[model samples]
Target: MHKYFTIFKDSYYGYFNYLWSEITTFHWENYFYGLIVVSLLVWGLEILFPWRKNQKIFRKDFWLDTFYMFFNFFLLNLIVLIFLSNATAQLFNDFLGLINLQLSDFQIVNLNALPYGLGLLVFFLVTDFVQWNTHILLHRVPFLWNFHKLHHSVTEMGFAAHLRYHWMEPIVYKSILYIPLAIIGGFDVEAVAIVHFSALTIGHLNHANLGWDYGILKYIFNNPKMHIWHHVKELPENTEYGINYGISLSVWDYIFNTHHVPYDGRDIELGFEDDHEFPLEFTDQIIYPVKKKRSKSA
Candidate 1:
């Protein structure tokens, strides 16, 4: 128990220092700076292209979403995620030890044997496929959707809205992703950072006002045009969870037959049926999922 507690404490300080260094240093691999660059560049595109002509540059809840970006990205890690992830991984390792099992036993492909470039590609694809499945679980599972509802609360989408999800989301996504990625790809820090930045940029583009579908690659990667339908207030008839659950790749949705876009769908309303009554304040939204009145709206 003391060891786990120490692990948590060390993770908190370690992650804080790492984030501080990312902010202070000018490095090619800085995740913090990568966030700012992706945000501004995509916002510039929104300003230039003007997808929804009537939507202002600072659309509704713009600042709110901006705060969410910082909170979910930096502050959340500073407070909880870093320690939780570190501690959980430690505990899981202990459990695996009791059973005399190890990550090596589960390794299907040794990334070290492959060319480093192909190793990176394999890492990105495998993790992304995991996230895509996790995204579907977020919608299909009722309790999970309550937390996910805050993201769906975006009536007017923009680049910043990409990260406006519940803090519980990262815990859920990362928890589901941790083991599979570890088993398949090993812990290639360089590969992880590259995939993260790539997904972050694609996520911004997917939620931005632009309507790009990546031309012929629409079948491969996710873009704003296809992702917009994912926000529609109502899923198409007979749909259970939702459609277009892809995070960084559209191929999953297409292959799973969950893709739906009968029309342009640019002007469609966003959010669940009761979105008007949903909590808007950040604090309220954080607690909204766990409060007594969740199951009704879900």
Candidate 2:
């Protein structure tokens, strides 16, 4: 099964490579262009088609999100890539070798056999499943939730709120969950990068305040309209949690029975009941969860 899946994944990657080459001439500049285009599209959608009326973009949140965007792209990703690449390579090689399995032995099918967009879609779906489970675990386990709760304290939900996540998240999700997937030759570096970038962009889009009809697309993918509701203050209402797990598609949520679709335009309040006393400043946000835990213990 592992070998067969790897062959399938590689075949998809090969198709993506060929299609991307044909469409844009395969220049390094074109790769950067794709990145810029995606980023700009996300920004434009946030402004033009917001999900919630109350979750308007604020200057302070915008600056913080910008800081995190730069931090993750420039520092966190680079550091994780450097530190974990070799370790991941060894881990996967050892695991597969123990089972006498190798993905390279499988033959490649025709490069153009599969749709290139499907490759991007599958990449997002698989990674989002892993991320959603990781997120649930962080919340369930007390120690990890200490850091994760800082994210939930956001009073507003918008594109920037996606970046308001705890710093520990990238470490766990990218290093542990994503690296292993990449190591088995199931996904290439480019695909993995695309998944990360697309997930962040889509997650932010889902959190934005703009209103737009996703129509049939809402059933297939996550729209900001559905995701803003995830930030609702009420517990069970807030707990409509795992719907639209994918940054690009909602297939995983549908598969896992976590998908939710709202019918009405309801006014939902954001922020945690416990977080009312805490400050939203970076330093306070960082330390408050820890202090709260300590006080509970004492």
Candidate 3:
């Protein structure tokens, strides 16, 4: 009994300390500020020039998405950063030591060594490319598709809808992103902050109902119109794997021949075609990806 109790105590203290460290590391104030700023900006745009003019400001699942925005941004992301990213980084460090190749030596370009603006651009382009491929793999792999389907299950696109992803998703995304970016470490904390802010703005914008056509820039950046097609029920002819997988830059999609833009929004139905049985509640949705029985039956 004493042995078991000692083991339990050690485990409890370790977890508690880890949690406190992670909580402290997180920029709570900045996160809230960004959320509030982006929310107001996108909310204003949606109300002023909504793509589906008839859609209400507080559409169906609006509150649900609100909860998801908080849950994912606050809790899920914290877990990924604290646990998954740290573990991956440690493993990578060990691997580098074994190979006698340090991370600093392999860095393609150190953002700290470059001009601030140039560093920001390089980091943004590199990270976006990494994420672009990750997004594609999630779509192509059946097991990953089951988890990623939660994001696509959003019938109504809004700013908060950008955070509507499965909890497991951030773990995979952050892990994949950490290794490559860590080795390429010119991007200091400030550069990362700038890139993250840009990502937050563009991600919310793409998921927003705002009817910003963006004209020729649609080819340059992923816009509302182009991103909407990604959620459309059916894909265009000759496109099977999926289209518009680009998160920030549309150039990747264009280069890979996965870009699809319609002449006009005709029948823009969102969400999966056969997702009628998908869970409507937040708790159920959280567990949906991990429901082994359901996956087996499907």
Candidate 4:
């Protein structure tokens, strides 16, 4: 009994240590402050320069999304990322060993050896491509759609809506990207930090209800209007599945023929077309993906 208790204690303490280390190493302070400032800035802009003039400042289900933003950033994301990162790293190592191969054997160029700016550019491009593909899969795959549908359930859009995703999302998306990043192994911490910061900013902007078009550059970078169409209940004629899966760069959507923007204007009627009985409460939303229901295209 004493030996069993000792083992339990060690296991508990080890898991706690790992969790603490991950939280401390993740630069939470940066994201905490950045999110606060970004939220306030985007919220202010949306209020002052409203895109949908009829939309309310305090729209329905507003507080639920506020809870989502806090839940993801403070709890769910940190846990999922840390756990997934560790698991993926172990699985990757084992798979490589089983294949009798090494990452060094696949090396073409050392991206880290390049100049700082260029290195960051390469890292960003690689990770962004992985993310874009993952976002597409989340929509296309039937099983994955359940987890992703929570984000689309938002009828009223706002900056906080960007972080409103099912808890499993980051786990799958980041784990898939981890394989490539681990294999390449040249990206510096600073380059990754820049990529994450940029992604966070772009994500918030894409979800914001502000009224600024990016002109010709909208073809390259994702903006509010283009992304808003992504959540629209209606789609352009002849398209069945969702469009605008690009996370940061609109170029991917353009290249893949998934690019969609209304010639008329942004669609105000956003969310799944058939979501008449979707849950509004935060706890209900959290359990939504598990509930038995016929899935429909968003």
**Per-model TM-score on C-alpha atoms:** 0.96, 0.68, 0.86, 0.85
Q: Candidates 2 and 4: which is better by lDDT?
A: 4
Off by over 4 Å in 4: 1-29, 103-107, 293-298
lDDT for each residue of candidate 3 in 23-93, tens digit (9 for 90 to 100): 55656436556677788898889888888877889987888888888778766644444554545555677
The CA lDDT at 273 in model 3 is 58
- The per-prediction tally of clashing pairs is 0, 9, 2, 0
RMSD to truth, every model: 1.8, 8.3, 4.5, 4.5
Tens digits of per-residue lDDT, candidate 1, 68-184, equal 998999999999999889887887888889999976777788786799898888888888899999998899888899889999999998999999999999999999988886677
Where does candidate 3 have its weakest 10-residue lDDT segment?
77-86
* Residue lDDT tens for model 2, 1-298: 5754564555455545654564566544343345446556776776675555444446336776656555554444344443354445556667879889764544243222346667656555556667777766666677777777766776665565666766666666666564435433364556556665666566767766666438777767677666655555665544533233444566556677665555543456666567677666777765776787889989
What TM-score would you give candidate 3 relative to the actual structure?
A: 0.86
Question: Residue 132 deviation, candidate 3, in Å?
Answer: 0.6
What candidate 2 gets wrong by more than 4 Å, as runs, is: 1-40, 50-60, 78-81, 84-122, 178-186, 237-247, 261-266
Q: Candidate 4's residue-wise lDDT over 179-294, tens digit each?
A: 67755566766666678778888888888877655899988888888898889887778767798888999999999899877663444688886777777777877777777343
Candidate 2 clash pair list: 49-210, 49-211, 50-209, 50-210, 50-211, 51-209, 51-210, 52-209, 206-224
Off by over 4 Å in 3: 1-29, 99-101, 292-298
